[model samples]
Target: MRPFLASCLGAACTAALALPPAPAAARPADPSGPVAGPEASRASDLPGGTQSLPLEHLVPAAPGAPAQDMAAPQGGAVHELAPRTVRPFSLVGIVWDDVAVALRGRVQIRTRGRADGRWSGWQDLQNEKSDDAPDPGAAEGLGSAAHGSTAPLWVGASDAVQVRLTLADPHRAALAVPHGLRLELVDPGPDTPAARTAPATTPEATASSAANAPLAPLGATEIPAADQAAAQADVTAAGGAAPAAPVHIGARPRIVTRAGWGADEKLREARFVYTRNVRAVFVHHSATGNNYTCAETPSVIRGLYRYHVKSSHWRDIGYNFLIDKCGSIYEGRAGGVAKPVLGAHTLGFNNDSTGIALLGSFGKTAPPRAALEALGRLTAWKLGLHGADPRGRTAMTSTGGNLYRKGRVVEQHVISGHRDGFKTECPGTLLYADLPSVRQAAARLQGR
Candidate 1:
């Protein structure tokens, strides 16, 4: 059984203990980050038809761990390996960065035992906020720090894993995806079996229910399966691993939203829709404590928009995508989000920004760990397909359109936040602090 984390209010984490705490873990007051903990996000099917690491749903183990040897990475990496029995199993890996002494990121430990080909799933060892993702404390800023992280993962033998990581500096990407840290396979302790492992999954009932409910396709036509290949071709030509850049991506390839003609759904602090052809991503936080499941998000969005558009008199939902406290990504604001038009969310940077509204104001909230990883995976996939450089200073600079900051407006082609081009905390202050990590992650996947 997996562990279900309950203490996480937004992004709070409760780390488990081990013998002689690692040097970094012993460091006091990471006011900006969550300490490491014991967790296993099994990849088997769970309840939501999608998979989220069920925190607190742990299978209790015996005390008294095994003897082990720690293999440290050459650089600022904390690499350690132990047999499932020899060491008290928990998530493990290296700390990437700690800007402002609060904001931190890491190229986490992945794969319980990969080099030796033990059957363990890839485990991201990012010390994430216990609730959603990178739940930055008050000392911690926001953005990726609030929702994303670079912690390593812990897995057993007999699993194959792919490690994905992002760096804190725009200049240097995490070595995890490439070679930030290395893994050494050890014998599974005397107790656990070395069977193969996969990532977690959502419940079928919930997944089916969400699918049956039937929401409208984002404002654009669904990229047909045949065209999916074409879309890939276009992306490859644009400067990805191939040559094309993938400029578009639909949400959760597993679930398909059909196109419909109707009014938008009501959301929790805003009225919104998820349609159109959005081009770039502008990230934000919801700052709420409620945890959300993917199946329950449509109604949440519906109620939110009712407040924002109708109650607040906004044109549409401020964000195009709402990442819930449980790490689910919901659609918002249809017209501009679906299209590449500028938005009201960012100042002087809406023209091409596709605002992804995280379900809480990160300055005060923590998102789910799944949410952060999902964002990383999604962002990487999207940017890779589009050939957009998350950290690249250069842009097409040819978008001749009206952009705006605080609704004042301007024209731009880069993907940025409200603070970058404007003078307001539209995306919140903490989010700006982690943009570098976000962009760096995206840059690595640009045009895949």
Candidate 2:
């Protein structure tokens, strides 16, 4: 019992570390489409109950017109897919081939509501602030990194969709047409009315209750064999057994699995890929807006999963886990929640880390205390499994990016905000500011 107590409790700790930080903002209004036309014919099956239609395959608005480059197409390309009905799909999004090409323009979309049979007003898709690496705009074949996309916008219960791309600022644009454009339709499965009436519990309440359990004071990030040896020595020094070294049990939060959220696992193209040791955890905010209830969170996650895998073309959901404003922890990606599942959340460093995303945009509002505490508890358990101290720093070689060029060796905290690795206000300013406290709380959980 003493040895078990020390191995688990001596394994978690933390410290403070700082690192670097994207810009792009232009709002588009409800730009209506010409008409509700037929759905495009170039549809490809994607892993999760979704389909992708390439812009290149879409015929021009007027017959006989040559295909235009998406960036600066003549008079701004306004192509629409012929309208075709399908099973009630609930989400739509745009996918592009290049991440580096910053278009000085707006991309808008509209969907035919399944219930009304009427097309919704044109809605803009965000082109800036991508969470994945850049895609090469190649002609022959897409490069390994040549897939990027916008955050999927929720369009409730839709059956048809149409899209248009326009260069708002023609002069300063990259002067290149978008090599490829794709639209995706995702079905989040039939609504689970029961989800609305489900009971809510403090996700970390069980862990918090055992907060007073005893633990070895572990200040260092590394919990080597010497610590265990010392614990045994302490027991010997205290008569027969050191009062059973009160075992400090760290409880895991009640995580909602992908199935619990009604995810169509078959839609995923392949099984999850695992990485080696998880050296760090990157915290991020979805930046997808904060207008949602705890009940609507699963729907939001399903949309993001479709956006990431189907539209963005990533291997899986970028984060290993997700947290809602209500402090619920969700097992993100399909891999075993306990494994070192590589995630695509932080660019250039996805292989050695795990990403924990808070489910809403936190740029303006401070993250809920519950959400922050959930993060702390999450890191405590995750990092502890790897014998890492949450308060300490570790080195990782960046594949390269705007902040740290490729092949750069950067030292980051075991628990880091997304900005620490990439140049983005990712976890949000208010949330980034809360990271220090998160590290401290995690350390305390480890008895550091």
Q: Say which candidate scores most in TM-score.
A: 2
TM-score of each: 0.38, 0.65
What TM-score does candidate 2 reach?
A: 0.65
Tens digits of lDDT, candidate 2, 295-375? 877887877876676566565567888999988888776555556766777876776788999977677799999899888
Per-model C-alpha lDDT, please?
0.34, 0.59
Model 1: per-residue Cα lDDT over 334-446, one tens digit each: 43212242344442334444566655454434445666654654555444344455554433222211222133333332345544443334345666566666666555444
User: Runs in model 1 with CA error above 4 Å?
Assistant: 1-280, 288-296, 335-342, 381-386, 394-415, 425-430
TM-score of 1: 0.38
RMSD values, in order shown: 17.4, 16.4
After best superposition, candidate 2 residue 441: deviation in angstroms?
Answer: 1.9
Instruction: Report the Cα lDDT for candidate 1.
Output: 0.34
